[model samples]
Target: MQRPATTPLSDTAQATGITVTNLTKTFNTDSGLVTAVDNVSLHVPEGSFFTIVGPSGCGKTTILRMLAGLETPTSGTINVSTGSDKPVTNSMVFQGDSLFPWMNVWDNAAYGLKMRNAAKATIREQVGHYLNKTGLTKFAKAYPHQLSGGMRQRVSIARAFANDPDVFYMDEPFSALDEQNKTILQEELLRTWEESRKTVVFITHSVDEAVILGDEVMIMTARPGRVKKVIEVPFERPRSVLELRRQPEYGEIVYDIWASLKDEVVGAAL
Candidate 1:
């Protein structure tokens, strides 16, 4: 929250989970080659909830895309291994509803497991469980278009969790929902996450969301992005967002992040 400090908050844990070193990305545009991220480095421990918050176009999504193997880094290295044989990120939920409109809730939720050729019984069990967890089991037969925006996002979460990937990468998954729906989904996600304790890297613009859901929150600089600082969350698990927000420390943490973000956000806007 002070000047953009280079000294990251200390966590001496050895890096056995996701490790990134000097990660940079650029794109050759009509104007010229543009660097979007610059020499960013960090490490995420396994089974930890790591959240990232940054100004828009600060390469947040670009960084995530590289981690998910959807894009290649221009330079440097990104090593992410969850030991789940299926894939590194069979578990990503985007800000928008990424569900297939043609598929019903059950099929959509079961899609990943089915693609992995999981047994019918296993698919039924996993998909049914996630759907129920997201409060969508009764609407299992409904297509995406037949459901409300929140319901569709529920299906996306259900599908992502049902896949049972070792790591989850969520990019502002509840950004589009109303406050009530977003709150409900946050609770649902925490409940499911507690059950498995899987690793998750979530990207969000909301400081509250980042603090509430993450074990550690990384703040990124403006365009040509870089890691600014890392702060650890002190709250324990099985957290209720509502309850967590009531504490004085929660308000202070949120204020600190937002206070730190003002300058970067201003730069990004220009």
Candidate 2:
């Protein structure tokens, strides 16, 4: 079937970044070779907050791993521009905070910079900046066990941002939080993105989250994932989580994505 045409962003508003061509990934299982992603092709404009949403085990994480160069693709290419004078950095935030038990929050956030051999002065400044931005400055000296789950996740986000990555890949980072914490993190994430304007590829199962957070939402098929649809969110920038959710157009976009995925979701159940 012919996919719907993507709504083009204006040149002035477009982000300049990466393109994926005929991306496919498969894994060798005991039973047989299992295809996780199939011919998935998409472009993520520079500095745009793009998201991919699908059911569990639909290759969302597989795509992210490939982008991070953690996994090689069976066939396909991801083209990233190296035009920036500064080195390009990529950071990921997984479902768990992945903070070290022995390290305090400040230390954890500085780990990435430390790995890069950044100057002690630079590390201190960057760590302090992001911790303050994520509102975790007070808890900087606290260990992971000392903070709440939400605060731990905030540290994770702070760590990622501290590195000043070119692209940020988040896989269901807020899925574990309660409703209130999730909402707060959502707002914090937007604020971070606004200030940094890094290219982001987020994977989630929540349709509402996709609509609220994405510049474009790429909906995938049940398994052997493909780009079933790409829905643009034309709402004004710096949107509030509550206000955008209440918009009629937001509901329309959510329902449209649902209509496209309902059949695939049902098929997966069978």
Candidate 3:
């Protein structure tokens, strides 16, 4: 397949600082070609929190993997610009903590900085700053096995933020937590995003979570995933989850996206 031309972001769109153009991916199996993502194009403005949500096997994670450079796309382009002077850096937080078993919380959080040849002082400062922000300061000495699931996830979040990445790609980072823990982490994630002013691309199965966190939500089709629709979330920032839920438009948007998703999900199930 021929690669599509790069789509330039418009002046208005450039404010978000991330552009994904004609992004497609295919996998070759013994059975034949399997297209995971097809002709998907999206623009995420700088400092905006964008989200991709779909049912299982819809290629949401595949799209994120491609952006993280872990998976090569069969075609398309991902353009990310942090600023004029600095190179763009991206950090990913996966579903699992993936922390080293022997490493303490602080060490796990400092691992990236260590790899970058950062000074011990710099690593200490960055790790301390983010761990405090994520409320994991007390657990800084605890091992991954000693911490609760939520605490481990906090360590993951701190570690990602400690890298000072220009963009954050999260793949269901809070899906494993209990309801209360998930809600708390979600709020903390937003607070961190607000403070850092980094672009974010999050993947989730929950419509409520997507609506609560994303400035814009992109729905994907099942199996051979494709962009189904891009919906702008018009709610104001510093949002109150309770208040947002009560808004009439909230239910309307959820229903609209669900309607579009249901058939594809059903078809994939068959």
lDDT of 1 by residue, 1-270 (tens): 111112222434424468888999999999998999899999999899999999988999998888777788888887665543333553788778799988989999999999989999999999989998988989999999999999998889889899998778898998898999889888888998999998899999999999999999999999888999999999998899899999999999999999899999988888
lDDT of 1 at 142: 90
**lDDT score for residue 151 of model 1:** 92
Runs of candidate 2 with Cα error greater than 4 angstroms are: 1-15, 85-87
TM match of model 3 to true structure: 0.91
TM-score of candidate 2 on Cα atoms, chains taken together: 0.92
| Residue-level lDDT tens digits of model 2 in 122-177 | 99999999999999889889999999999999999999999887889998999999
Give the TM-scores of the predictions, in the order they appear. 0.92, 0.92, 0.91
State the lDDT of candidate 3 residue by residue for 77-187, as single tens digits. 877765454567788998886888899999999988888889988898999999999988898998999999998988888888998888899999999998899888998
Candidate 2 weakest lDDT stretch, 10 residues: 1-10
Q: Give the TM-score of candidate 1.
A: 0.92
Candidate 1: C-alpha lDDT: 0.86
lDDT of 2: 0.87
Alpha-carbon shift of residue 94 in model 1 (angstroms): 1.5
